[model samples]
Target: MSTASTKKPPEVRLPPKPDLELRLDKFAQLATIFLSLVGLLFVLKTGSFLLAPVSLAIVVGLMLAPVALRLEDIGLPPSLSAAAVVLIFVLVTGSIAAAIAAPLASWAARVPQIWNELQLQLQLTSFSEPLATIRSVREEIRNVTGEPNVTVSVQDGSPVESVAVLAPALLAQVLIFFASLYFFVATRHDTRLAILKMCSGRRIRWRAAHVFRDVEGLVSNYLLSIAIINIGLGVTVAVVLWLLNVPSAPLWGAIAGVLNFFIYIGPALMAVILLGVGLASFDGMPGILLPPLAYLALNAIEAQIVTPMTIGKRMTLNPFIIFLAVAFWLWIWGPVGGFIAIPALLILFALARNLIPGFPWGMPEERRRRLSRLP
Candidate 1:
């Protein structure tokens, strides 16, 4: 009897099961989120004609919003504020176009001459191997595919016809961009209030407010800071190149400033362009390398020193994330994708901080500092 009593085990305890309705609700929520994301990406990829302009407009508007707000604070109407911002933007763009249009056209005119020089130089140097490998690969592919020795030619259309074909689409995009930008700026307050009102609870409204504020502040401040830094970079490059006797130094500087916005890819492309320009404009290997090398040095200073001091980590994103965003958008919409990638990241991260629990994006200074101290 004693042994039997001792053999009795403690009463077993079981945890309460999750409610079926609650589990089902969570699954439904997750599924809805997944489907919404898929649909959004599909629309973005397929609707570039409309979406790209809208996206660019939104980013531009976001950046210009502070100006609009300042104007409003100064007793200007919303419409007037939006108009002033847009007009200023137009003038800035026009100035940039005027600066580079002639140089770009001249370069385009010299492409054949440049190509001839490049070929001649390559033959006399050790840099032709890569091109030779490409040709050899082409021959191998032709052999594999049994290619026909047919020559196909494309006829150049009249300039008028080309313009006629192109102008409407470009005009449409411009109009859409202007319209979206104007409306977005004009409705800034109304839009924010509407967003808050749409949220069902006080917590959600507060989060929405944070997201709206952060997105506007992050995109505007980052763009403004970078633009200021790039302006300095452009002026530095222009001065350096002018001293170095590079033709169209200002144009190259302008190009550099614009391309620097693309981060790594822009600089590499700029280096290659400068290399070609140097080779075309000067003689000997040393002369050919000077411009690009100088640019690389200046770029190093800006990227390493100026940008970090100016931008800090307030809106700093992982390079991998930016690269992927650029690559993804590039696949969808080419150059426009590259321009919007950073802005898109800023907006997404701003929203993520407010919407996603335990997520690290747009983290506060204290939290970020704590993270930096971790192993």
Candidate 2:
């Protein structure tokens, strides 16, 4: 009688509700994109030896593409035009290397002395007591843990051995770079056409075409403009350092120019380097402070004024975005990554504008005003 009073069947498990399903689908898509990005990054990092040079080649090719086209307009064949461009590039690179070699070598020879001086200076700082306390604590921890002081000796290989190990890979990468550059420059037009033809629809083809055109134009203009600005900066730095009686003026100038390409990290590093240079060269605190402060002032002017004017608002990027890009690439590929970060961002921006519907280029003043009117 009690059992008969009330026995009900179990409730069946229903499929997810429509809203829940929709959310799950969106989450899956996001996860897929994230995983794909991680995979791409892994490939890029592991294949850096091959990919790094190839990436450099692609960026250089894009930058030099207009020059190649101009040569072709003069009735030069693509092969010869590309060759000429590559040759010019090689010559320019060689000249820069030669120019910096002597001063760089002199500085390299002074590394040990510099290190000692740097250590002495650090010990003179207010933080030295805290550093000493930290070192003592570390020693005490090791003693308490009964960990023996392990002397791990690494034998230095012969110079020839090091070079021999490195040279083949370096030569291969260099060869890959030149070959890739030459072929890319030569086939760029055909390559664009080929990509367009592969698209399944008129809309797709149109987008592809714009992507190519925008990428080339934007990258070339941005790089060329920055190059001009950096050259001016370098020259100004050299003159300033020379007037300040700093040794290796040209070397520091070149370093400044090259490092400036890396955005935030570069200028800060240059300041630190200049501080060290000052320390090595002069005895007074005023001397140590002068070089970094001077450079900082110049950098502030360039960044706040000249760069904006030169690059224009259209080409200008968000500072936070640029910083993130630099940090990500620097982590992935070292200095080379930093060098190519902006161009790569430009390429992605071009792609996004073309591929994404209603994606704005530059977010014009009128558009921005309209956006500002929104709740």
Candidate 3:
């Protein structure tokens, strides 16, 4: 008691309270970021209808730019020149589609026979044991479901009818794309000027122009080179199929050409189809294996040799980025998205590189390093 009375009570000190406004501001910032992410996802999910047309327009513009430029060089007005290029593209695409329809129809009609041949080939090859195992698994599934009579059918209907039904939609899409491309080409200069005006400073405007030019050159060159390479691959496949006496060789080749747009998955699917057809047409494993081997060889040449040589130095994309882009687009818009993924990626990469300082953005240094490491 005496000690307590002699000692002055130490002044109790409490920590300062956090500022509510600052805390609230930090929370608000986090919420805004989360909501923005959600909004972006929603747009991607629902915006395919809009994106499809725009993407198609970009591709069409790339393919037609040279033609339009040539027409302009010959003294045609830009608008008229763009129109001429679009018309030629439409006509050529239509002709090719029409020419291949009948052969594709034949191939579709023969699906049942093809399956049977594939079954026979599997029975004769090293796959026989695996096929038996699969049969056993199917039997177990049937037993578990109490449906012993369950049968699977893989047959498809007439390819011509399928094409006919889809033709209107395809035509509408083409028209929209071409119309948009025409405007884009005609107004490209004005568009650049507008962009420059909107930018805050000279440095930004200069960077924007450089990025635009780079994107245009990359996309145009990629489109032309891919077209040539795909055509060559198609012809090669067609010749091989014809030599092998495969039915509807031209149709298969056309399918190959279209599928080639999808990269790794495309060639794999074509190989499966070829194997099936070979099995149906031939009685031995040798025949069945030929299609896959031929496709593998052709793809190897295209991927390893042709693409590298033709697209050299200019096509500077990270493989992982390309794969991710393809997957993302395919998830959003199915096969159409898959077909346009590369060009879409190129545009995005160009924009990102121009806008961000630290990012690689498909630059020459990055591309050269990547190619140097490739086998």
Candidate 4:
């Protein structure tokens, strides 16, 4: 009976193993990064109304920084210089818009004619049967559902009404853009100093300074060079189109130039637009093909030869990476996102290379070594 009363002690539970703890810590870090990225994307999309214009202003400010600094060097105050720069930019943009307006208005006035032409041309193709079948099916479905065709009359949703609704927001964004540009320009130097001063250590401060320098140099040079290249490309497009008797040659050229900024998507869109232009202008195959084909040839030359020469090897970025960046930004912010994508990538790359010692993933070996050697 005494022996039977004896009982075993309870087993002890040991703490988690070191390896398990390490894995959990790593997972927590990953989770934090993922959450941060998600939050950032959410903020960018939701706050696009403010963020988009500010982003654009910052890019524009960087492009014009050299001009602002030059003005300051010539004894103009930062405020005055910023104002002058902004005014000049507005004038240039307005001039371009004005140059485009008359042609655009004329073309818009001919939309019905173009639509008819497009329909006729499409009917002449193999797609006619498929399109007709789809239309018939749609009509049958509408009938079955007892749904009348929706028509937007002037009272319902006129362009004027739409513009009136949107104008205030547009005006506000414009004001925000201008104000952001002015302030960024005025405070550029002070901003740099302030950032550098906030660094915790000498090495970190040095890296930060280089990051700023690299960002300013790369962005400004890339933008300025691109601007020059696009102007040339635009002029070339205008002359070629004019020679081909394409209507609104200057307008198309200007559109081409502006679109060229978006890289792959832009050129492809321009081609589609030119195809539409071709269909609108000409009745025969040669006429229809000439505009797009000629533009393609010119674009090929510019992209392959002139652009590389102008921007230089140092400014070159991976095409795939550029496309991805453009896609991501465009998805988030529409056209403004597309406009800022390249600059944003450049800025990110500069920061990464300066701040991280082994960030040579996309860099050339020599360049990576060079960057690694930096303090």
Against the hidden true structure, what lDDT does model 2 obtain? 0.85
lDDT string for model 3 (230-348, tens) is 99899998898898787778778888887897766788898888887777676677776787788789888988778766764456665567678878887877767877778888887
- What TM-score, to 2 decimals, does candidate 3 have? 0.73
1-375: candidate 4 lDDT, tens digit per residue: 686578677789988679988999999999999999999999999999999999999999999999999999999999999999999999999998898887888787777877787788778876789999999999999999999999976557788998999999999999999999999999988999999899986667767887888888889988988888999999999999999999989899999998998776788889988887888899965687799999999999998878766654656677668779879999998888988988999999888777666676343467556555656
Instruction: Residues 50-159, candidate 2: write the lDDT tens digits.
Output: 88888989999999999999999999999999999999999998998888786788777877777787777778876589999999999999999999999999999999
Of 3 and 4, the candidate ranking higher by lDDT:
4
Q: For residues 173-228, what per-residue lDDT tens digits would candidate 1 score against the true structure?
A: 99999999888888889988987898886666666787888899989998898899
Give every collision pair in model 2.
none
Question: What are the clashing pairs of model 4?
Answer: none
Per-model lDDT: 0.86, 0.85, 0.78, 0.87
Query: Over 4 Å off in model 4, which ranges?
Result: 1-16, 133-156, 300-312, 361-375
* Candidate 4 residue 299 C-alpha distance from true site, Å: 3.6
